[model samples]
Target: MTTAFDPVRIGALELANRIAMAPMTRSRAHGPGATATELMATYYEQRAGAGLIITEGAQPSVVGQGYPDTPGLHTAEQVEAWRATTDRVHAAGGAIFAQLLHTGRIGDAALLPGELIPVAPSAIPAAGQVYTHEGPKPYPTPRALTEAEIAETVDDFARAARNAVEAGFDGVELHGANGYLIQQFLSSNANRRTDGWGGTVEGRIRFAAEVTAAVAGAVGGDKVGLRISPGNTLHDIAEDDVEQTYKALVADIAGLDLAYLHIMESAGMRDLTASLRARFTGPLILNPNTLPEPTGPDALSLIEDGTADLVSYGALFLANPDLPARLAAGGPFNAPDRGTMFGGDQHGYTDYPTLT
Candidate 1:
């Protein structure tokens, strides 16, 4: 029987354990040009015990940034800064992947540079507020992408994947979930275009497929992964045909021979999860059941039962630096500080005590 403690293979890389640290936004990328700081390296180094660590969402381009202080993977300085963190993690015997995210309609212009507004498949505004340096503000109506610009956006993801490799990351994961740019195109309500980028199921899934193929072309397919959420309503997204949308999306990309497919599961979507699990022939990483609590020790059984190839933890891994050791011991884990979870100093960032 497989346990979370067992080793798993993702592409050419061999993970030490099946327990993975999910990508989370800590809002602590406080460097110039959104470059990673040495302090950030310390934070990841502390958690190097995990089999794999997926870093926070990094904007692939300047306009892709949706929040203040998030990191990027588009420039030489940014790549050079990230190389420090990746070098440290590799030295500590850990594998890391940079998640390339483009927040289309979920951002405010104040968060971006040079007065550039958010871009989406359509001009609709998400019905919520995004946090900025000033505080929380309403989401601005995004400019719709032109047909030429859509091709350019795909190129941006490919370029970022190349940049990620240059920074010494083991791989790159496309942020297709969580109401970001990729999901915006997948959303029925958010994406109201009639072009090849949106409209029917095939058109809606086109952008995602193109980006995946482009990234795979840039970085080998074995070094690429894609994350998705079927029925997630975050950022005021609504999917009338959630099942059809994701099944088609999975089928379209399954032949890419990618590294993994990560699903951020929502409430009562286990059947859909099972279907996707069956359709996708690669390694499947599941952050299961978004309801009563964060993914807990109980989810370890998902691996034993073959429901997931690897299990990802967000808050649990954030608070417990040596989470795998704690789990192996049936742990008395430390609780995460909510207030300091976002943008703060070392109090909640790297100050979490590990069970020694």
Candidate 2:
């Protein structure tokens, strides 16, 4: 029988344990596209003991960037930068994946190079101003993407997946949540298009399905994963029929042979773990998430009950570099300072010490 802590195969990859390093944004990219610095590389290398590590959301293209200092896989230099990090993790006997993200309406074109109009499925602007290098600025109304343009965006993800593999990553995860482009298409409020890309359930899901197919084809379905939140209302998203919307997505993507379906049980929504599992035939990684800082409330029990194949943790990994050791030993954790959570010195980034 398979246990949560026991090694299990997800698609073509086999993991030593079931604990995963949840994808968290650190915004430490050394300016330009996705140029990860030595410090960023070391930060992930230190936590290689986990069963899996999912890096912060990486924009597939320049216009996809949400934060000022977030990383990207759109350039040759950026791929080289990530190669060092993935090499380090592989040397440490770890498996890692890059989360490909496109901010879409969640960003401001003014903050991006050439003021790229921040395209989305519709022209609706995200509710709030995005924090940029200069400061927070009101989000500009995104120009709706033409049908041909939507296809181009899907191709961008395929190209990024190839870039991720070239950068030495084991696999790639499609960031389908938190108000990014993928989620925008799934959302009724954000995506009001009447064409092939939006309106009805299947229409709204067309873009995501195409992107998933594209990435899977580029990087092999066995090596690709997707992260989603059913009732996630972030970034001005509003999904009317949460159950129906996600059911279709889970069913449609399962045929692609994805590694695992990562569902984030975010705030305000009824627990979706059971409902989501019904549609997915692959391994399931559950994020029984809490506030900014996570307290799992017997997170292991979910695995014990067979509700999830693995548990991906976020803030806990932020404060404890050796998160597996701390969980195994039951040691007091170091709290991450809010000041350094975004972008700054290594104070809150790599300075946290492992329990000795």
| Best-matching candidate per lDDT | 1
lDDT of 1 by residue, 210-328 (tens): 99999999999999999998899999988868999999999998888999999999989999999999999899999885644444567888899998999898998889999999888
Off by over 4 Å in 2: 1-3, 267-271, 291-297
> Which digits, one per residue and each the tens of the lDDT, describe model 2 over residues 1-356?
55546887887879988889999988888755558889898999999988999999988988788776788898898898898899999999999999998989887676577647788889988887787768889888998989888888898999999999999998999999888899999999999988877888999888888899999999899889999988888888999788888888887887898999898887655356687787788989988875344454367667778888998988888888888777766666777677778888688989899887
Candidate 1 ranges beyond 4 A from true positions: 291-294
Q: List TM-score per model, in order.
A: 0.98, 0.96
Supply the TM-score for candidate 1. 0.98
- Report the error of model 1 at residue 254, Å: 1.3
lDDT scores in order: 0.91, 0.85
